[model samples]
Target: MLKKTLLAAGTAAALSFAGAAQADIIDLFTTDQNALILTDVGGPIFSQVSGANILGGFRDIGLQVFSDTGSPAARAIVEVSGGVFTFSNDNGIGGQATIQWDGGTDALDPGVLNTTGLGGVDLLAASADRFILDVLTADLGFPFQLRATDMLGGDFTISLTSAGPGTFEIPFAAFVGVDFSQIGSLSAVINTAGDTLALDLSVASIVTNQVPEPAVLSLLGLGLLGFGITSLRKTKTA
Candidate 1:
């Protein structure tokens, strides 16, 4: 009964302000160690951080550790259940990890992706006007590629430099040939340049939405939804 009421109330609140553009934060992936599963691996062909590690409704995400260049044969110790996705490389194998976010439910698919609008929310449309990729901590000279796939299988790639304790604003105009309104998924391909490297990475989006305004709060009339208010701000600091 309580769950039904909360859901109904939330729907009302959303409909009440459907015409307005609100500021909100869309958490893509968080590596907070407080609640995580400790998985230790060495050169894993395919591995994933499931259960609580994956956010609700975005169940198809995947994490893969690999060597970009196969010659050196990179061996990595990966820790995905913590404040950072730690990738420790022993040799100069150019260690890297691929974060697959394109929503796919195929059980055989190694690269799992996220399902679009499963929660009745258009991630890109409901969030802020700008998209800022926030990487909390990482080794120096770390490089990554952020790929955005659309409904038609078209992709837009953005090369990212590791700016630990800071944020990078992805330019809106850079996503050429991509439909912003109908985005399918987003993948982060992270890499380490050093021979022996210890890289810690956490990815998220810092968006601007206007849900905490007094007018909206007063209309919602539910304190249980206070958690949403707290999510408006970034929990991690640089």
Candidate 2:
């Protein structure tokens, strides 16, 4: 009797765990995925970059990065690395963006320069940063638009990795529609990049520290205990 009961219970627990995976929204990635859309450029986001050591900053800038096309929530990974000739931010690392982009002398795009204030920004060839995104099929429908305001004010360079199909590159990119622009009532100018970013979602991902929900975990544990009992009963009966 105990053996029979344990077998049944064990089977039940294994099935329960399997059901949990199916019940999930079929999502992947981390909460940091939103970082894929760079925004709110400012002193708070970065300090300053020097050829030798990264300098501190005294300002804040606001900004945002997004893809003009495709669905939001899709699985994707962003890779940002900086050094001497790579993507660098915040004093050539992951501290600050590299410029100012509002208007005038400190205007953004190609005219950006190092200043004492936060405005627009970009990463350099010596820094690295990353963000990952993953949304299931249910996350699709309307376009995926995430915004990050220029809280500080400086330029930043980010490498966006995506799961959507695109050009010849991995994760695709030909018709990826990477339209990076400033948001405003009258549509601001978008500075085109001079470098090629390498973000292959097929091989990159981020690790997060978020813990699984306790209730869910407890349920999972209970399911296993039930299954084990069921199995033991089955063995004893045999």
Give the winner by TM-score. 1
Q: Each prediction's TM-score against the native?
A: 0.53, 0.17
In candidate 1, which residue ranges exceed 4 Å CA deviation?
Answer: 1-44, 49-56, 59-75, 90-93, 112-121, 192-238
Q: What's the lDDT of the predicted structure labeled candidate 1? A: 0.41
* Model 2 lDDT tens row, 69-184: 22232222222222111111221111112222222222332223333222333321112111122211111011111112222221222222122221111110111222112111
**Residue 161 displacement (Å), model 2:** 21
RMSD of each: 14.6, 23.7
1-238: candidate 1 lDDT, tens digit per residue: 0011111101111223322455443343453322221122333233443343342323233333443332343444444443344444443334556555443343366354543322223444664433544445445446556565566544567654443245434433345555555666555556623322434444434343434356644644552233121111111112
Worst 10 residues of 2 by lDDT: 1-10
Residue 64 of model 2, lDDT score: 28
